[model samples]
Target: MYSAKEAVSANNISEQFISQMTIRYLTSRKLVFPTKSILDEERRINSWLGIGACGSITYGRARIGKTVCMNYVAESIRNQYGSREMVIIWNVTDHPETERNFYASILMAMGYECPRYSTALILKERVLNELILRAHETPFKKAVMFIDEAWKLREKDFYWLMDLYNNLSGKDIQLSVFMYGTRELKDLKHSFKLQGKDQIVGRFMINESQFFGIQDPKELQFCMASVDKLHVCMTDYEILSDGLVDFYFPYADGKTFFDISNDFWEAFQSVRIQKRIAAEDIPMKYFIDSLVICLNMHGKLGNSPIAFPTRKELESCVALSGYGESDDEYTK
Candidate 1:
């Protein structure tokens, strides 16, 4: 039979163990690590907002973190400007390329029900009124829309978007648009230019940037450093004091993820070289996936101490990340 003090101590240990496991699970499932790409995209978008541009295009390959970057930017804008501005993210779907569908999509994105019986004119009015109401809530009377998967939109769609832009302008509300899509979006811009659709090009595609993943060893190190210092916060509490790296490898003598970044980068490059993939961009999805794999493989979970990952372990992690397999599919 345990004494009262001993029972309390055991209970405390059990609670700590449960909390650690919970954090590990949460981090594995969903963790947002800041990246340079997100910062650069934010800067570009802010510039567009500064100049009052109608819209701009941001194109990248699939899974390069464009959507995540846009998400971060939208949140940043909302936080920075607060109630002075409105930010909305609309994901363009592969629906029919018609004015009615376009307006309906916008209405849906704004969290409004789109009745199938409503005509295009009614949908247009509903969208405009919604925007105007939202914009009026803010002091600046400004609204920004981010169109994700924008390559799904055809040229005719832009004319409809332009009509909304014009109507919002007439209402004295400033609407700035930003389109995020895959490489096909750039192709669409080129096609429009070749077809001499200067109006659409000038309004939306004039300013553009290509998004990339982890580009070089330096960038990989930066990202790893971010992970090393990342503190998981829940309900205003910091769960992991030393981030995931230290949590997993508590006996590594203070080694962090940054210490193994070079090895990880080399391992990644080796895998790509062996697979004969020419692309150098390391998609964030696989990068984070690989890190999570490593954590699961070596995490001590407060039971025992573990060492940091070696180059061979990291190589296995990268290979298992499905980076090579995805690259093959992408190339084909």
Candidate 2:
């Protein structure tokens, strides 16, 4: 056994060692999915609104890359629409700000320069004016104001949104608003109260996307390959794809890829540092144990609604009696 200091000076250590592995893997280049969904929800949005001044809302479980996806969508919009500088993306969940304050934030994101009025209603109107005024300059004038973590917005906020849509109703200006978050913002419309205002709910034509399930088979293999990249010698094994996919999601549940990477890094580092698992001799037992540790740290063990005995599930046979059934099945 070597002391912490002595281990550093020791030779033949693995190259995967890092001074600080506590940070999220977003900092480690995990956010860039080499291939992304080209048009995340554009087809659907435009399909819903054929004429002009359309709107869309995207919703999904928390930490499932909804924020990142929305950003990608915004970027794509900007790229397609050359004068896309008009589009604004605003985040409104931090510090418990209300819809009014959020309007102020949106105004700020849209380059609101007027210092004349500071009231909520005034700010909202002024923001509309800026967009309206810009649209008159060029027919290509368009803006997609993406409001993130919008579940925090109460029903009262819907008024401001309605006003926004109505204001831009009759102009060459196109306002495509994108709202995303965890709320049953979908279910919010079905409520008896909101039913009274069906027209209001009809404004955005919200679309829902949930990441509550395991990754697709293709994605699972890619995820494992990404993890394999962290290893200098540990090659990616395809034999365990089905097993690992279940393990990862049920363990990390709805976490993003970055979250899973960070989560795995921390758990791996903790187990290796605390018990001093050597670089070369790290066993499969320790690897599984570290994964279990990550599951525990991320607060998601029993949270999984499904379970499996890897031996029985993977090999399709009981392990009892020297895995007698497994042996017989293998022979056949």
Candidate 3:
């Protein structure tokens, strides 16, 4: 019944005492650390659902973790509303911009297989019926679909979606389509507007939000604290009674990841400045990558113990993360 930190202290454990299995679990598992961007996006989605808005778009730069944020928000919505709503996450793939492919994608996302010989009309019917059935399970008669990689969708795809939206309304089920994609998604909306596709823009693009990376030291600290608080687990069992920070830096004189945010931020800033990259926000992918690099390089697994990472060490980790390398041209 001793807490993780207490157990570690009681046993006088050292970095070498941590098991390889625990390290593997920590490195391999998918961990969702909460962030301000995620919370804000969740709130905006909740507001849209509360008022029964038709749809909305969430766009951000590549590697900023828009997909992760949407997935988190989808789960959050399901937990909050329980059986009152049906949420589906559709990862839009590169396919022919045809109505048949569109309807087939929806069916596939909902865990149903589409017959190869099925016509677009047949697939559309199947999708509509399936959605109606799911909507009927909930008293609210609501179905929400998050379209990830939505920038791949074309104008014709939006018209097809509009048809589905209209059909669902006819059946008294409110369908909320939330699109999560890259900056191209915002440009897509503008493209639609210029073409006078007002209805399409009105339905899905009216209420939109842009996702961003860690904007400053404060935000970086928030994300670091979140990682510190996360429980390192294997399936349902906790490997340690204490959180990740405590387990990794148990002998750091009680200094937590929160206290090292400045160093982390400065390290990233130093890398950006040296690279002459103009992007101010630290992409979430690279941020997390840098963090994992830190943990693996300095934690128990690496057999190198430090109370916290030095600025130089952090800068090397950030550079190794390839934070500004891939998207420099776009950002510039």
Taking all chains together, each candidate's TM-score versus the true structure is: 0.86, 0.54, 0.88
Give the TM-score ranking, best first: 3, 1, 2
Across residues 1-332, which tens digit of lDDT does each residue of candidate 2 receive?
Answer: 33222433554433123111211331332343322232436554445333554665576443335665666666756665555666677776554445557577667777665464577777777778877865554456665677787666655666777777677865556777777765465556456245687555667644444322113334433443554333111111102122223333344344333334433334334443543433311222232233333333332233432332221122211111122111111211
Candidate 1, 246-314: lDDT as tens digits: 446667887778889999999999898887776788888778878767766666643322577889988
- The superposed Cα distance between candidate 2 and the true structure at residue 167, in angstroms, equals 1.5
**lDDT (tens digit, per residue) of candidate 3 on 68-166:** 888889998888778523888899989998889999999999988889999999999999988888777778888899999998999899999999989
RMSD of each: 4.6, 14.4, 3.7
Identify the runs in model 3 with alpha carbons over 4 angstroms from their true place. Answer: 1-30, 234-238, 303-307, 328-332
Model 3 lDDT, residue 197, Cα: 94
CA deviation > 4 Å runs, candidate 1: 1-30, 231-242, 301-306, 327-332
Error of 3 at 21 (Å): 6.2
Name the candidate, 1 or 3, with the larger lDDT value: 3
Ranking by lDDT: 3, 1, 2
For every model shown, the clashing-pair count is: 0, 0, 1
| Model 2 misplaced regions, further than 4 Å | 1-25, 28-30, 34-53, 94-102, 111-117, 133-138, 192-194, 206-214, 224-332
Best by TM-score: 3
lDDT of 2 at 258: 36
Each model's C-alpha lDDT?
A: 0.78, 0.47, 0.81
